[model samples]
Target: MTTTTAIGYENNLPTNDPASLIERTIDVPALGAHDLLVEVRAVSVNPVDVKLRAGAHAGGFRVLGFDAAGIVREVGDAVTLFAPGDEVFYAGSIDRPGTNQRLHGVDERIVGRKPRSLSFADAAALPLTAITAWETLFDRFALTPDDTGTLLVIGATGGVGSVMLQLAEALLPGVTVIATASDPERAAWVRELGAEHTVDHHGDLAAQVLSLAPGGVDWLFTAHSEGQIGLYSQIVRPFGQITAIDDGPRDIAPLKAKSITWHWKLMFTRPLHQTPDLIEQHRLLDTVAGLVDDSRLRTTTTRTLTPINAATLREAHELVETGRTLGKIVLHDGN
Candidate 1:
């Protein structure tokens, strides 16, 4: 019998207490035709991990992790993009067991060749955030590097914001980025990531953005949009676009009058719905890896823990729950 070590929760827990996550030895399931058995080396926690824990399945343990970087130990007969011994990075599907275990099985259509220059932990931090940022800017907003415009990024120090700011700077040639970070430390971090100017998200958002671009920004990307849809509508130019990844019901009526375009980017949509374009995730991550290897973009890993385990996962979850983390936190467990 083949078994692997994994950390999981038996039921939903309100808090990220150490007891909420537990270690277990579980059987490695048989792979599907398109599955790639990944020897998980490093993993990163995201907001969705926390949100999913709130409603975790009750019948059995639920493993929660999305971003992973590792080597492919085995590949299904139908797989073509990757094979055994290939280094890879991916954000696994929401419908399948995640990459929190020592071994995980994911579809080849959604995985990418890992950047040659990055360590497993650094590569682990890129997938989920990179996919979200890439999809939001290119797919949702129809933006191209040649497009000349101004972009306003709110909550610019979080995982998605950190990557979005960099991607915008690298991909959009003639655009200006006005990012919002609450404190000096976060402000400096975003600036380092290529934000042209920084404003305080805790202060007057619209006023600050207006001060920078009095005519209004051509595009707006909000990492945290709980009560700021109205403000986004105010600061974005008429017929301009707005994109967001925050979960929750938001009243988007404010932008209607101005005929402003708004889009919600859920990185899991392709996997969740089993869309025919699911392979696009593979293509996107591959492109991102090339950019990273070319020194056009860098990993956003702000912290890393040696060896993956339940206790460390609990600590990582606690930090993610604080809603104050900069960039990404990764846990590395080498093979």
Candidate 2:
């Protein structure tokens, strides 16, 4: 096909507006030497998509999405890891157009073979969150199988935390996870994902955590930390490390006495920077696929919508903005 159908937006607007997302046909994106032309089958929404939509001011329509599961339709000359017909999953680069189109082009280095056990919709839920979770644990926290300590995860029922807990269960035998959930449903959900303990984020976090671990947790990872640094400072052990995929803490003054080290992780960093280790994403996705096929890890897809289009995309974006979602929300072309 010379062109493909896509859902995108021409300006920043409230998702409730009919103009927020529009369907159009555009020329199929050109491929770089390492790019793969993929026929996208499924996609999942992330908070980044919501943020970008509200703040973006593209001169033309800007496609919005990151996570995708698809099949290779064509491969660039330098691509050796995959070829036409290979089933694949990946989170596209922040610097690129994205994967919300019928045909999307992405670097092969950031793509992976989709898990044989999962359908495209299920597979789509894994890439973006899985990449962020994997990077937060192994790359930012530098966790290993031999490491023995407590990991406190805020927003434990959200996309990243859901997968992070599962990855820890499969990869970190010695580590104990304590997750923060707002209510009974979320609390029970995180426990099933391998959280050793769950604390109510709406209650006394420090007291609850202190009751669970008197000396405080060894590491802390939070998805949203706009004004929670004071609370976090009271629970983390001295010299403990912290990583945040969101805005992180508002103030570090309370944490200074404990000599805490805070790190920021955005899975897009490597790809946007074109880092030497950009291909690590490919390796990690392949590894996660193996885990999924082995039944050691599972997709966190909580809801699936069909017939990806303007209306559906806007609906999916609004669902994410509600902040009540348990896991990932996905949409597919039904191909």
Candidate 3:
């Protein structure tokens, strides 16, 4: 049995408003045959949370967190991967109430044991970014661990880009990484994370990339503005794959001229739709944990806020919306 206690809104509305997040307690139903009861210790905010909170939807209070690191308080009858008291981390399904509360019931199939070396705040930032970067490299672009080629990452100091740069260095040995950071501080940050080269995104992207790799990059991952889709195509090698996680109105015709392949990576697609490969999220997260524990992959949490509440969450949202966050912003502990 799992006790239900949470803090969330009462109706669909913008969280930017002071009254939008009405803290309240509610009953969490008993765990299903395959669910695990989680006592959330820390949670991270992403662009998705802000969008969902402000969007028009059915008039009902919905929880809006995706990334969490916590302790397992209970387990379903059929659960084998985890047990009560196990420390874990996960990005819960978007279709369900999120981890913004004191406790959350999540499917064990998409959760991983927390890294032994990381604090809950650090672990909380890894699930969403790690999954996005891993899937983009291995699943979408089909880049192998041994692939030795030049890779380009746009918005290199962002949540996903920070992790993607580290993963590329750790997994793809001998591969050269070119990362884009518009400012000097971000460029230094990306280089510290393992980028072989860095360029300013504020200038001509195609020209800067061409100057670094005269032939063109073998793979390009865009974590920033979707408006640069055409620009990416112009700098990618023939038959090279370009992957993006952001969505916006843009012309993709430029890719056709270079015979460049375009790939869209939505990290939530598998969990949101309950696809047959939903278990892959579990496997990938576990792998990430092992890497972290072994001192291979690094956490990307750049800022932390104490006491989870509407005010603190709103501040975190403002940081993300500013479009200048280097890594992730996390909120921990219930007030």
lDDT of each: 0.88, 0.92, 0.85
Ranking by TM-score: 2, 1, 3
Give me the overall lDDT of model 3: 0.85
Among all windows of ten consecutive residues in candidate 2, which has the lowest summed lDDT? Answer: 246-255
After superposition, which runs of candidate 1 have C-alpha atoms over 4 Å from their true positions? 14-16
Most lDDT-accurate candidate: 2
Model 3, span 1-335: residue lDDT tens? 34455555655555467766666667775788889989999999988776676664624667778999999988999899998999999999877888888879899989999999999999999998899999998999888866888999987898999999999888898689999888888989999999999998888888999999998999998866467766776789998988888774367887887888888888888878888998899999999999998899989999999888777877787688777998999888741
Per-prediction TM-score, please?
A: 0.96, 0.98, 0.94
Each prediction's total of clashing residue pairs, residues at least 3 apart in sequence or on different chains, is 0, 0, 0
Q: How does candidate 3 fare on TM-score?
A: 0.94
Clashing pairs in 3: none
| Shift in Å, residue 277, candidate 3 | 2.4
Q: Encode model 2's per-residue lDDT on 1-335: one tens digit a residue.
A: 79999888998999889998888899999999999999999999999999989897767989989999999999998999998999999999989988899999999999999999999999999999999999999988899999999999998899999999999999999999999988888988999999999998888889999999899999898988888888888999999988898876566888899998898888999889999998999999999999999999999999989888889989999999999999999998673
Model 3 residue 3 lDDT score = 49
Candidate 1 lDDT score relative to the true structure: 0.88
Q: Write the per-residue lDDT of candidate 1 for residues 101-216, one digit (tens) a residue.
A: 98899999999999999999999999999999999888998888788889888778888888888898888978899988888888889999999999887788788989999988
| Index of the highest-TM-score prediction | 2
